[model samples]
Target: MKQETHTVKKEFIALMAILMSLVALTIDAMLPALSQIGTSLQVADSNDSQLIITSVFLGMAMGLIFYGPLSDAYGRKKIIYLGIGIFILGNLLSIFSNSFPVMLAGRVLQGFGVASCRVVSLAMIRDQFAGPQMGKVMSLIMMFFIMVPALAPSVGQGILLFSHWRAIFVLVLVFGLICFFWLHFRQAETLVPEKRIPLSLASLKAGAAETLKHPVSRSYMLASGITFGAFLGYLSSAQQILQHQYQLGELFSLYFGALALAIGLSSFANSRLVMHFDMAKLCHWALIVITVTALAFYCYVEVLAEQPSLTALMAYLAVTFFSVGILFGNLNTLALHPLGHIAGIATSVISSVQTFISVLIGGIIGQLYDASVVPLVLGFFFCSLSTLILIYRTRKTSAI
Candidate 1:
């Protein structure tokens, strides 16, 4: 029975990962098709094209604010069903959108749909597990997400090759429906019935006030924000940088696939590394790796040529991607360590704050795109330093 229970939890977490993975795939998959969409919609200002990517994350920030508490009041299973239904609605809307503005609205709603799964997945893991083990589970879940980015661009391109870009939305709808079915039939409620809290106006006010006062929670929250913001920076611009700047459109898949695999492998390493080293130590080292790589890219872009080659871009950026695996897991575990009593509210608040800031920061920075690789490197460079400073501050406070 113990073994059977373990298997059930693993399978449950796996299902959640599948749902969360859609966010990354949906965002990146549209990259190769961005030009086609713009031309078809007759969108002016090609740079504004990234609105398709950033708007969803913006919606996710709003969704994260509610999903966790709803899951806490109800159960993970029910909230997830609502998220899927909404996600399907978004996909349908997106498939039919003929203009950039309409498409942007559809993407925003899609982000909202997935936010529940993203936050609730983390909460459910924290709901059932704790300590280093929780970090390990989160890492494993992220490993699957890393893999999604690897194939997602290629998969989207393959869909484009066979049909209109609208086909991508149809595919997303199919995937969402399948997940909804899987959850409806097989998954049990991870949150205990009695433990669920009523989400009220009073409860929201109290949860926010309480979370703000929690230093450990706030530290973890900042840690998650800085690193994830750095990641969002990459996600927003990497494909454009690789495909358009470097002119490697079709070949973008092989390079993206490699970098993504590096992230997954690094997460596996982090799960093992965290078992032996502390979270702070692991994260600091991970940043160091990324810093060195970012610096190298900056150097190459600044000095090398009229345009730095795609080879240089991938070589350095892949190293930067490796840090995401470590930072994503450790920061959350460390942040939530002291907020066990309010995991649902705290998780929701932290996730919303993290996504909200990351999107704003990443979206603003990504807008600085040029005909060169300078913007990508500079964003990574500055964001890495900001992350280091925040972690340093958090460490000093923790010691006090």
Candidate 2:
């Protein structure tokens, strides 16, 4: 019985992580191909290429609100199936895209489609776990999810070695199809008929109100957006910074993978430590680490008045992102802890708001790259500082 329960838990975590990875893979795997795709499509500016990344996020923000409510009303499995279908369609659109706008449109649709995977997975997790255990489970899920980013760029680069950039979409489409079948066959519907909320405007409004009205949820939700924006800034500019600026060229994936490994390790650590510490405290200290690291790096870079050595930049990023890994799971749990009854709507509103805010901030940061790490470091510092302010506000509330 014990082994059976453990096997079941492992399978559940793997599925959830893979579901989330569909989003990460779609985003990260495109990094290597951004330049190729941009040039192939005759983009006017190299910076504009980052739009390919942020556009998906924008679509996710637009689609997130609908998925949560729909999943709440319908059921988790059906919504997931629907999402995968849309994702497949998006990939096909991208595979056949002849222009930049068409590619962006396809990417947006891909994001919109996969938005179900993200929100529904979280909703299902909330259906099963709450409080610190939820945080632990999230950390465990992230442990696996982080591996996608670690390897996606390299996989993407490898694909480029033998095929056109469009082939990446074909790969993603195949992966999406496999996930769809896996969910259909292996995963049970977590939100049962009796527990499902009837889909209605009034119910959605109440759910949104309940989610935002809670002090911890509102504060952490904003904090998550701000912090994630910092991460997204790196994502958007990573190709330019690593390939063009540092001239790592073909070796860019290895460095990106190292930083991803740092984050993954921290997530694993958090999963163990959550049992011994408060989730809120973990997030607070993690933000403190990120804020301090970014601030010190910004100062160092400004004093040098040029791009810092690759080693210094890597050191700083590793520390900041490792801390970021700790914060991700904990902050999510803190935000949704009190909203389990409305997890579907709460996850939707929070995910939508955060993704929208992050995409805007990340888009600006990407545009500000300027062939130096200064903009990226500054973006990180400000975002972490902003999140620290919000986290402090949450502390003032007894609900925390």
Candidate 3:
């Protein structure tokens, strides 16, 4: 019985990681193909290629607002199935799209479909764990989730060696199908019927109001969005900065993977560290570190009057993303910790606000790319600094 319990726990963690990872896989795996996609779709501005990334985020932001309330009324498993089905359909749409606008629409649909996984998985985690233990589990899940970003660009690049960019969507489709079945067969529904909230306009209004009213939940959700917006800026511009600005050529994937590995390793460390320290303290310090790192790098680049060397840029990214890794799990856990009773609705509201803010902030930063890293670095500094102020203002509140 003990062994069975252990097996279930391990499988549960792995499954949650994969479900959350679908978003990362969808975004990062397409980084390598962005240029090709833009060229094929005949985009007038090269920078417009970044929309392929942010459009999905825009979809996610829109979807999260709806998925949460529905998941609460329905069940997690049903929502997961629905999300995967929509994801597959979106992939097919993208595969056949001939115009940039149509392709973006497809990506938006993909984002909307996968938003279910993000809301449901986090709600499920809330169903099973709480407090620092919940933070620890989130960190562990993140450690695995981060791996997708580490390898996705490389996978996308490898696929391009022999096939067109559309083939990449096909690969994503297959992976989505596999994850769909994995959940269907291996995971039991975490939200029970008795605890299910009825879906209604009034109920959603109450849940949204409740989530917004909780000082810790509201502040942490905002802080999460503010901080992650910087990272999202990095994601939206990574291909342009690394491949076009730095001229890494085919080696872009290696550098990208190395930086992703930094985040993954930090998440692994956070999983253990959460057991020893307050999750809030970890997030507080992480915000400081990234804020300072971004400021320093911006100053160095400004003084040089040129883009920093690849070595300097990588060093800065490694540190900033390491800080980002610590913040991701801790911030989300803090926001959700006080709202577990309404996990589904709460996760939706938090995620929707967080993702919408990120997309708007990140999309602006990406559009500012001008063969220099100045805009991206400044974006990081401002976003991190803003989060630091937000987190400090809410320090008196109990994170537990």
Candidate 4:
């Protein structure tokens, strides 16, 4: 029984990781194609191309607000299938789009649909695990999830070399189809009928209110928003910064992949280490590390007015991303820790709030890109500092 259980758990983690990776694959794979899509669509401002990324986030933020409660009322599996269908539709729409507005709309739709996979998967995991154990599983899941980003840009670039940018969407659609069928055949409905909540507006409002009333969860959610905003800023600007600023061109994917590998390695390490440390403490320290690193990088570029060599930039990014990897699983586990009973609605509300806030901060930072790394680094510094402050305040309040 123990051996069987262990095998089952491993399979579950892998499936969940693939589900989550769909989001990363969707976003990161589009990075290398942004300029091509922009040119083909005749975007007025070059910076506006970043909208291709943020639009999905916006749609996701909106879609997540509802998927949680609906999933809670229905069941995790059905909502997931529904989300997959919507995601496929969005991909098809994007593939057929000839204008920027249509493409943006399709991206938003894709994001909105993908929210089900993200929210439901987190909820499903929370259903089966909790505490440091939950952190361990999430770390393992993220270990696989991070691999998507590590290779997605390279995959996108390779596709662009041989085919039109639309091929990327086709790839996403094919990937989603595989996930859907695998999920259908292999995964069982984790939410029991007796445990399911009723689908109602009042219930959703109450759930949201309950989620907000928890000081720890609320604080962690806000911190997550701020931290993710910094990450999003990096994602939105990374292609331009690498290709234009460093003149890496096609080599941009290699550099981006290297940074992504740092995050994957750190997540793998965190999976092994989380069992020995408190998730909150790990997150607190990781935030501090990122804060200091970001501040140093900002100073190097701003006050010192020195352009860091490619080696120095990559080193700084690797450290920051490693800390970020540690924070991702831990912070999420912390936010969802207190609300496990209402995991579906809780995950939705928490994720939606965090994503919404992140989109605002991240969109502004991305738009502020001035062919320099100053805004990106400064965004990271301030966001991490704010997150650290929130963690401190939450800890103090919790002790009382």
Candidate 5:
């Protein structure tokens, strides 16, 4: 019985990882298709094409606000079904879209729908685990989750060779269907009836207040927002930087995949290490490493007024992403630690607030892209510095 239970737990983790990865798959797979989508839709400004990524994040931020509360009341499985249904509908709209606005609308709907998976997965995990164990599980989940991003651009590029950009949406729709069915058959509801909160405006307000009252949660949420803002900036501009600036073109997906692989490896390393060190200590060190690396990279590019060789650039990015992999799971675990009782609404509030802030910071940084890596590096430096400050302040106030 003990061995059987351990095997079942491993299967649950794998399923949760796949569910969470669907969001990354949606974004990263679209990277290789962005240019084609822009040209097909006759976008005027090349920069506006980045909106394909940003719009989804915006929709996710909005969707999280509602999905959290709804999932808290209704239970995880039902919410996931609704979310996947919406995700498929959004993909269908995008497949049929002839205009940029219509396609963006579809992407936004996809993001909104996908937000359920993001929030509910975390809530489900929280329902089962907490503290360092939660951090370890998240790291394990992220290890597998990061694999999707590493391979997605390659998948996207492959599809583009055979079909139009709209076909990418068709692929997403199919992926959603597989996930929906797998979830329906294999996963049981994690949220229990007695624990369900009443869904109402008053409950929403009360949950928000309850979540915000915790200083540790508030501080870590802010740190996560700042750190992810830098990541978001990178995602929004990675295609342009690799293909246009470095002129990698067909090799762009390979380079992007390599960077993602770095993050995956780091997440795997973090999973092994979290059992020894606390999440807070690991997160602190990771923030410091990323901040220092970004500063060095920014100075090297800004002072020399020359682009680093591809090898040099990748080395720096590898280090930055390695630290980022550590930071993400730990920061999220730290933020959600205090609100486990209300994990659904708490995860929603934390994710929504952080995502909205990241969208603003990242969107502006992406817009500032000037065929140079300086803006990207500076964005990383500032965001990591802000995260470090928050971490310092939070630790001084209380032991998390």
Candidate 6:
């Protein structure tokens, strides 16, 4: 019985991660197109281009909050379908867009739909796994999830080589169909009737309270939010920072790939490492390593007053993201650790809040983009510092 249950659980994790990768591709593939978008739409400011990236992040972030409790109430399969449908519609609309605002509108739609895949998939996983086992599964899930996002720019660049820019959405549509059918047929229901959470205000209050009531869960949630915000900030600015600021246009895909490869490699490493270390201690140590790296990058930008090479920027940012791979999966497992019973709701709200706050902060940071690396460096530096304080205080407050 246990072995059968475990098999079912692994299948769920595999299918759900693939579902969320559609959203990943939507966001990551747009990196090479950031410059094209600004020029085609005749937008006067490069910073405004960030709205394209942030719109989806912001939309998904908000969508995630509601998706959690709702999925708990409705069951994962239905919500997953609903979310995919919405994402496909958005992708279709984006394919028709010729203006920046209209394109952003499409991105927003895509984001909302993607949230269903992301938040619901997470809720489903948390329904079955926890601790080191959870981390191991999520790490593998992330490895697949990371591939589409990491290679999106490369894919986009390649598509652009032989086709119109909007052709990317066609791919989005194709993947959406695959994911929708895969879930519709192959994936079994993970959330049982007893697990259904009603979407009442009382439910929200109760769910939020339940998650927050636990010291470990609360710290992990808040820390994950801040740590994730740093990634969002990176996502928001990476394209513009790399292409426009660094004058690395055609090479954008290669650079994006390298950065993504760093994340993928580190994630696989993290899965193995977690077996040897406690989740919190590992996350805490990863935080220290990233903070020091960000600070060093910030110092280099400030004192050097010279434009860092593409090699240098990618290297430093890669270090920051490598820590992200280490921190994200474990932190998520930590947040869901004690909430096994309410894993669905916990996954939703935790993801929603973490992403919502991160996207907002990241969008703001991206808007600070100049023709330099200072803004990106400073953003990561401050983000790391804030997350450090939040985690430390949680530890202190818990002691009290």
- Candidate 5 local lDDT, 1-400, one digit each (tens): 9999899889889899898888998899999989999999999988899999999999899998888889889999999999998988889888999999999999999999999999999999999999888988999999999999999899999999998877877887888888899899998899889999989999899899988888999999999999999999999999999988999987899999999989999899999888898778888899899999998888888787788888888999999999999998999999999999889999999999999999999999999999888889899999999889889888888676
Query: Using alpha carbons, what is the TM-score of model 4?
Result: 0.98
**In candidate 6, what are the lDDT values of residues 1-400, reduced to their tens digit?**
9999889777776786788788788888888877777788898987887888889987787678777777888898898888888888888888998787888888988898889888888777777776788898888888777888778899989988898778878987898889999898888788888768777889788888898778778777878887777788778888777776787888878887888888788888888987887767777778888889988987887787788777788788888888888887888887787788877678877888788778877877778777777877777778778877777766665421
Compared with the true structure, the alpha-carbon lDDT of candidate 6 equals 0.81
TM-score of each: 0.96, 0.99, 0.99, 0.98, 0.98, 0.93
TM-score of 6: 0.93
* Clash statistics: count for each candidate: 0, 0, 0, 0, 0, 1
Q: Name the regions of candidate 5 deviating beyond 4 angstroms.
A: none
Span of 10 residues, lowest total lDDT, candidate 1: 304-313
> CA lDDT of 243 in candidate 4?
84
Per-candidate local distance difference test: 0.81, 0.92, 0.92, 0.92, 0.91, 0.81
Better of 3 and 6 by TM-score: 3
* Candidate 1 off by > 4 Å: none
lDDT tens readout by residue for model 2, 1-400: 9999899999999999999999999999999988999999999899999999999999899889999999999999999899889888888999999999999999999999999999999999999998778888999999999999999999999999999999889889998988998888988899989999999999999999999888778889999999999899999999999988999988999999999999999999999999898777788899888889888998898889877999999999999999999988888888888899999999999999989989989989999988888889999989998898789777877444
> What TM-score does candidate 3 reach?
0.99
lDDT of candidate model 3 versus the reference: 0.92
Model 3: weakest 10-residue lDDT segment is 391-400
Total backbone clashes of candidate 5, pairs 3 or more residues apart or in separate chains: 0
